[model samples]
Target: MNIYKIFLLISLLFNTLVLQAKEEKISIQLDWLHQFQFAGYYIAKEKGYFKEENLDVIIKEFDFDVDLVNGVLNSKASYAVGKSSLIIDRLEGKKVVLLAAIYQNSPMVLISLNNSNIKKIKDLKDKKVMLTPDARSAAAINSMIISQGLNLKDINFQQHSFKLEDLISGKTDAMGCYLSNEPYILDSKNIEFKIHNPSEYGFEFYGGLFFTSQEELRQNPIRVRKMHRAVLKGWKYAFENIDETVKIIYEKYNTQNKSLEALKYEAKILKELAQFEEGNLGNIDYKKVEEIKRLYLLLGLSDSAINFKLEDIIYNPKKINLTQEEKKYIRNYQINLISNSNFPPFTIETDNKLSGIEIDYWNLVRKKLNLISAIEVINNNQEANEKINTNANNLKYAFGTADYENINSNMSMSVDKVKLALTTLVDKPYTTAITELANKKIAITKYASYYKDLKKKYPKINFVETASINESFDLLQENKVYGILGKLPALSYNITKKTISNAKISGIYNENYELRLHVNKENRVLLNILNKAISTITDEERKLIRDKYNSIIYEPEKDYSWVYKIITFLSVLIIIVVINNRKLNKEIKKRKLAEEELNKIAHIDGLTNAFSRRKIESILELELNREKRYNRGLSLIFFDVDNFKLINDQLGHSTGDNVLEKISSLVNNTMRKTDSFGRWGGEEFIIILPETNKVQAKNIAYLLKEKIANFDFEIDRKVTCSFGVSQFEETDCADSLLTRADNAMYYVKRNGKNEVKVV
Candidate 1:
């Protein structure tokens, strides 16, 4: 062999080693001692998901005094895992943002012997109740009591030494134990026990939260997205291969010296706590998160005002890889998606046509999959689940929450999740905590799986079980009940629609409940195909659905309604205005008629050619009186050019004035006589809609967004507007209505521009 050839091979090997060294290095800091709870990160690292993303991840196990938050804050680690304490830190205005939820349902429960008189939380009064100071269980117990209108003073609190012997000896009335921990020992010894879960009584909480600093998330979003995807993929792998995961935890990751049986038991309960069996693991529940905020406020963890937003913690998942077989399956198959009408922000039905987040998401899937699709709208969860469960060969898939348990596990799979909450009248609000609603009347259609135990526990509450969700809201509106019960994006949809007013969430429900993309159990090929498609839906795409439907903002080119009534009216109005002006101009040219020009100036805006301030105000006055007489909904939108002052400062005032004129022309054409569009003030515009609620008004605002955005401006080119939307109340005057709209608009301005907000 040639010496030159040998040298070339050696150089090639060295270059390969150098390329491998270039992988982006990062470290994860874990809170608490090493255990199976942190097994997902270990699995991700071992399986090369991090390597596949060109990342070199370092795992840093934590000790008691390490301060997991400071690790990310001071850059000791790129990311970390912490418990409920992280929520307290965030609500206290900490700099970290939670990335994902590791445990969807908290494991903390009050374990007591069935022989004891303490059955309900109320029964625990004057009895020895164990409090584990170091764990979230104590917090959970306190939360449970306060939520039911009881305080810690009512209970006989005992400081636990983390021993099971006292509780087993019946020396203590009850012990706070993780369902996976000491409870397992009791089960092994055949000790009968009754568990009191705080979550079942409306103390639902997120256990383990993954986090990073706001700066790190923003500065390294690509890194965040990559790590988030890999970690989630790792969780999926761990749950699917439980034995392997348990073996890894027992042999490799365990520092507690947990036996294989104990490790396996831990793994099983972790899956239960995380709701891994139901699916859509590692995602945060935005609704429950809001409840956590409220719970903390109730628990005195936060002050009266909450400074942090849920968006501060929640994140979108990045797409993962797909196989060729899965790709081929989607391309060749005709898939049918299960959806229900009136489910806004998810599934929407307007004028016999479908739109909203689900449509947008599935449409994207259809385009990518190259599949012909059909929407099967089963308005009821029970029916949808039954069809999919009993008739799996015919009915392929549907959307459901695990709380429903409507989908029989024999034939269904939960591919995703969503949060369910109860809506109550803000003016006459009721307590959401189950036991507190003892005698109060509340409305609900069908109870989810979580409700069965609640019903058995709180029987005194007068439940106005309705035939359907629509009826539930009707009951609330008629004052037949104190509150209405349902979940989002349905609850949010109805609220946005203004079908229910003066309503706020008094209670949020479901522990480990998720939006699942359930497929037929028998259809393995199709299941694999859809699972891959859902997994690969990118963060940007998810945001497009999750965020878009909430606002209902659509691009100008996307036409929702079939009727071109708006187009026809605008064309005729333009033609009439043009012909009259042209004729008027000829007469003025002949007779020098200054009077006609003066009349035009009086009625028309000089800068925008839209209705002048006086004309629009007169229209608003008439609409207000008419609305008062008929007793119907009337809404208004206030909007303004986002950077008008900037444009005027940079360009001449002429360009700025022309921008207002152009925006007016675009918006004026989209109006009905029932609606009025005018310049409210300099750079601000007002839209009045008679017989329109906040929901319908939002539709109008969304429709006009893209046109204004894409308007062809020659100089000082940027054109965007912030909008505030509101509907009239019975006691509302024109001033009050306008004020609400103004406030809503300012909220948009303060947060971010070029969006719509409703009040």
Candidate 2:
């Protein structure tokens, strides 16, 4: 070969080396030991999903001594799996942006044996409880205890042994465990245990928070977006082919030395926890983050009274796939915004800077679309209108404008609809009826579009013109007018702000209009982009924004010690009279009456407080007779706990009884008033739905099944029920009706528990 040929070969090799070097290298630090919990990351690496994005990914297992978050913050890792504690981490000045929420429900729960007597959160008060080091950062678990009025000091806390044997051998009465991990081990060993999940008592938290540093996101947005998409895709694949994912994890990534069966069990539970069935794999819900923030604030885990913008922590996934041309436009064009500063709460101008719901809304839209230009706040609506009319192409957007009226007018979707209401003094005899405002003087803003129409419709009403909403409210508050016609949000804000304490929203005007950002007809791309961004805003985000502006900060209550002291003295005097035998005959008579009351309630179940089996049977018989006469539809739902026998055998009969009572209470509360529910037998219950068909009855059964499936039973053990529905047929007898329902229930049990079947 010639020297030139050798040089060409070297050149080809050098080009390959450069392309390989271009593959961005990044590491993701796991929060725990290698398990199926990090299956997504593992699968992403193994399946070349990360490689597809030109990423050289490194998956790091958790360390006992190192801080997972600090690893990412210090640039040791580009990303990490965090718990809800990242919210506190952010509030505490750590710059962490939550990328995706893999686990819709956190698997953290308090676990104990049947003999531990720690059935509920309150039962753990004085027990020896073991908590892992990370448990301190588990906000939901702590809030669950605190919400039950128990302090951490109440328990003899111990460090986690991280051994199932410790719990089995009674080394600890209770311990913080993952719902996906420890419970599976006990199930394999045939050991009975209980779980105390925080979500059962309303402390729902997101687990497996995929996050990165804010700096990382800012510096490499495209990289971050690619990583997010790949990771979620991995999770979707992992759940869809669980057996295959389990085989890979057991064969390659199982650092915890987990058996294939154990790994498979963990995968199943984690899949459910991930809400894979609901789709949108790794989607972060802003409302859930809001609740977590509220919990953190309420628990004093973070700074109090802080106006934490949830969007600051949440990574807004790209909602609209922009074309190359559209992207180029967004990169080049600037937003010339004409905001209505006069609109309170919607748009507020102070210190030459505009702020309010609409302004914040646009900011979110601009950020989501990755627009290059900032919102240029013009002076006033008139100036904005004049600019748009003269230079429509230059002035791209304007707020406080009427809905599309001209051929040149184009608008993005409305951020919110403007609902009008009449505000008056609380003492006024005004209702939601517009007729009540007839023949009365009402104050309204002169600029209102409905002004002329309202005047024409209510001819008897005397209309008073005002320049602004504040002026109209002032007239009503000052008693110069019977009521003020204004926007609902403005009125609500004023009332909540205590600007006019005695005023109330008496009636809502029928005419409502949309409050949208009017885009110039010339900028159709901008309109489409704005519409997409607006569409991506969740209802929860909108509500949070509205709440931020109209939040009611309650004033401190006046001390009432004097009144309390008087009541205390009277109560003590009454107690002394009763204890001193001043009403001995009355007490005896009261005890006899209580006995009679107890006897009268024999028809009620002793444990669940539902109707007794005999009473339910009698009622069912009467219902069948009524169905025969009236020919009205009637149905019955028969159901029972899935693993109730195992619960009794492992957790003891006492815990089992508690589970039964909880199930009954949940079903009773969920049943309609016309429905008669009762305990049929051990772990079994029945409901009679009168005047209902099979489809309607099936719907009710599914609703009850969901309620039970979502409920946290004694010790947080997941309790599921198989439901059977049967409608009354003209030829059906009582036994035949029950048998059909029973057979259908057996079918659900034979197929899979926690499902509904109707026949």
Candidate 3:
């Protein structure tokens, strides 16, 4: 080798050694087995972001025996990834800094079958519930029950089996499931289920939090920042390129055996949950942390958690400012904000103009953030629910999204600022105790917060649902319902206008009336700006806004003009009624005469009215019953027109019918008042004798046959019938007697036309 080339090779070799030496080794303790829940980390490793940052990061699954907090604290794991609130850890002196949030919206949800009546978190009392062993998820569950004035002791807790079979097999009534996990299994199988999200009821918590001990941040800040940067980059890539990331995960890092499709779905859901698509990739908001802590403290209110502030849980805080790219993305971009049209103070619409405390507050927030906004008012709870379900930020700030956006995956920042009360008639006043609501039919708006959840919580109350609070108020006024459940503004507004002086605001449910701002997971770039704007809201400003709306009196104009108008209308109605009565009397008289004629027509057969078949049968049955009781003789002479089928087929039914009519007239002429005669059916007739022997009936039948045979029928020239005389038998019933008479008639027809046969 030449001297210059050797020097260049030696320098290149040294540089390569130095680059290799610079790579730092770190291990992240993930909460569960390998899955797309950790897709960002997997993507970072696979896509070489960690390598780019000179990191030789080792990803480890959490062992069942591992203490999650101690793992990082004791250096068993350099960092830990978990889905929980870290308030407990910070209070316990673990001194962990939350580096970045993996999922902005927690994927944890309490899931039940579609048919299950359990609708809300409060409904979980006395029901079987399965929870993950993790403290964070369990703690949230406990907090929920506590919020409902119940304890964890009231619930039947089942240990999670880490498989959906426990839930599918009915071992658990409700199971804590990840939106990215068990729900996907149900969805893939097209099984319907209901997801009970805590955030929906104002118990908002975080999910997939990435953190390390404060010592890690203090000693190796560069490496910590690198790790945070790399993980966030991985999440961004995983969310944006979902398909490609799923391929990388499934083909390489999959230990949970999650299908590529499932991973893809998980990625799509995480984008909304983590707000990666919403441009909130790994951006930590300390205000959200504070909100979580405040809620937890309120739920448990333990002394340890009380000492911890929002900053204690977050490592290094970044100021609320957007980059040029962020500014350009949001500038002049009017946020599609949704609110309630009828909800007062927080949200109200007057003459199509939406102005309320919430609106005023959000407007101020918008001005601070330098963004324009368009407000959408949800008219009812249904609209409120559906409005927020979008991936877009709703005023409730909870979002519903498209199918591909993944349900239960939207970042939520709860503004826990409202309350609700139950109103009842003053005569039927109720106490606030849930138990006291037993046997009462409480009228609630169908669109009430956590409506299904309310159903689950208070199974005792028979809920009469109304579309609006006004409808519930009407129901309450009529004494049709025992009580009404609504916000203070709604209840107060409704009761004051119902001038009957019968209704009063009664019991109040201490539920979290927190309003939330829901941003689409795909459009979370403006969340920080919004949060910064929210932070500027003074306590005085909040009180001022609320007080103004609360004190506004809605005095319904009680003009008695309506009463005078009603009296005038009633007088006119009475005059019309009097004239109608006279006309009705005359109509009634005419109707009675027409009814008499109708009765006569009904009994007489139109074609051949020889007492009618129905009348003859009535006479025969009465005579037979009398014969059985008194031992009196009774006889029936049944006959059919000889060769009737041949006559109809050869001569046409019109001619056949004309011949039968002539025969019936001849038989009627010969009948006695003591006897009854009628057409049995087409081409057939029957005679009933009240007190006659078989021989006597035979003679009568022969006479009738002879008359029919000689009678002229216009079309057939002559008409005759074969006769069968049958006496009532001791054992004969209606059907048996008819059969015997029919057999004798057949015999007569077999012998010859116009002949008599007795049986």
Candidate 4:
């Protein structure tokens, strides 16, 4: 052979060998230990789904203290099946980016044997439940309990080893279990069980998400895409061919105990849950992202870290495809507020009437400024912070006697003094008693700057950090601490006419701190409008509202022995009666009557004789349930008084109430006999148009808003209503349908409250 021909043959042979040697390798870290929950991944591995893709995938099970994303970041793994929230936390901590969510809803659930007879959520009251170590399921279960109006103390939670045997042996009435794992095991054993899905009870969280380091995403885009596609394909295959998948799982894991029947059932359940219609199989809905964020806030996971826009969190595998209209709408849009409620006098009751000084002041500001905006009066600082941080439109603003520390970037001495005074009032009354709060066993919210400073100054005080002002106050009321420190206005607002009468402002350590509005950065224009309005209002006018609503100043009285004796005696007597009766008949009767009255009061909005949220929930629940049962058409029409918050922020809650009442009355008067109406929540109200579809509902909602807008309220001004309408879906539940209606109302509020949006 010639020399050139020999060289060509050698080069071709070397290239062929290199190609054969290159088998693609991928690694996935599971969130927990090897279990049936991850059987699909194991099955895929053993069944050659990955091999078919020219990939060799390794499954790494995480033990305690093993950071999955850190492994991914360090290149030990390419992907992870963990929580989306954890992914978000990692992203915020600059650790990882989530690619897809393996489970659309969390598998964490409260499990009880059928024999336990724990039927409803209420049945868990006073029952001992087992919790796992550092379990996310525990938080979810607790949150579900709270949403159902039961406090954590209502249930006896005992920590248990991560074993179902404790529950089976009757050591605990119920135990936390993954719906995908333990339930399947129990079913395979023919052990009947009752499972409470947290998602169904409002503790919705996305679980089993596939996340990777940002560096990995950027460095090997093809690998990332291939891995996502392969995993999804594996999931699809496992779900469709369960028998084969179970065989594969058994071969790979060497597990003969879990039956094919159970594996098949679990695979089917996971497949239905993994379905996310947008982007891809594991794609997250940004709205659901916000919902989770709201849940975190409610759960006290972390202080609203960074306010994220919808676009920021949402991942599109096919990146940045936007139409002209979408681009324009998204770019100019403001963040939406998660929910709305009255802020003052104190938090508005279901009656929708203002009763405090802050409400009065806000009302005056609105009237004098001639401004319009929807204003929700939040009752506590934590709620205010969460609302301000999460509001998509950034329309939500915190107005009070705010501390300089709350609004300013840095803490000056004056700000510190103000914070101290505020803290004195809100926190347990502390004597110049301790130099270090660490020694005092004081529990404060983790992210509260004031508490952080207190810890720094008085490290000796035993500071217990909680998640929110409400929790902090709850701790204080329990006498867990000497006191709390806070800003003056919020402190003053919180202490008025509530329990905690023994609490008082120990001293005004700082007087120079003036209350200011904490406007979200995105809503700077709205802030400017507010500032201008504040500038125009005279000091006397401000004082009038302040005096009217916040006039009842609290002062701790000297303890008297006789008074204490009488109070103690009364308390003992009440306790005896309560324990003996156990029925809570009077309490239940009072609550039922209160609910009925609230319904009536809601029907005629307290301010304008319009419907209220209480009414809305009641009417909508009935109508929606009826619609579902009968397969009849029903539509929800949402209406909001335009610039309602602006009115509250500018005028005061009193004036806002006036505007609401006025608009509400007009709506009630304008409504047709067939229209069923009630307050949606906060500034929004809904009219359930039974036997009507989307088109008719849209027309009705708009007409009501228009009529209210054009009505001559003669209450020294003009106000308008915004409308949103949606027809009930076949799959719609109470909360989901309301959320859709709320989204529609938000659409109108965003576009201009006087208009109507149909979805």
Best by lDDT: 2
On TM-score, the leading prediction is 2
Per-candidate TM-scores read 0.40, 0.44, 0.40, 0.43
- Segments in model 2 whose C-alpha atoms lie over 4 Å from true places: 1-21, 303-306, 319-759
Q: Give one digit per residue, the lDDT tens place, for model 3 in 224-261.
A: 76687788788878887888878888988887788878
RMSD per candidate (Å) reads: 28.0, 26.9, 36.8, 34.4
Candidate 3 ranges with C-alpha deviation above 4 Å = 1-16, 114-117, 135-140, 301-303, 306-309, 317-759
lDDT of 4 by residue, 1-759 (tens): 999879766754553353243458888888766655676677567767677546798898766656665677788877777765553464356456677777766777889988889986778898888764435333456556665666667788886666778888788888877777788778667898898777654345676777787677555544555566567666666666767766676556533355667656666676666663422456676656764655555555555466656554444454423335533544455433212243333334557643444344455545643444345555455655656555633333222222222322111001011234424333334344345344555555565445544566666666777776677677667776666555544456566646556566553453233334455556544443444344344446655654554433434434456888999999999999889777778788989999998767646556545556666677778888789888757887766677777778877888877666766666565455567667656876677777666754664565565566666765555687767777889888877776787787788778755787878
Q: For model 1, how does the per-residue alpha-carbon lDDT over 251-360 read when each residue is reduced to its tens digit?
A: 78877677788877878898988988777477786755665665576558555364776776676544323456766766677677777674565677878888876677
TM-score pick, better of 3 and 4: 4
Give the worst 10-residue stretch by lDDT in candidate 1.
Answer: 551-560
lDDT of 2 at 392: 47
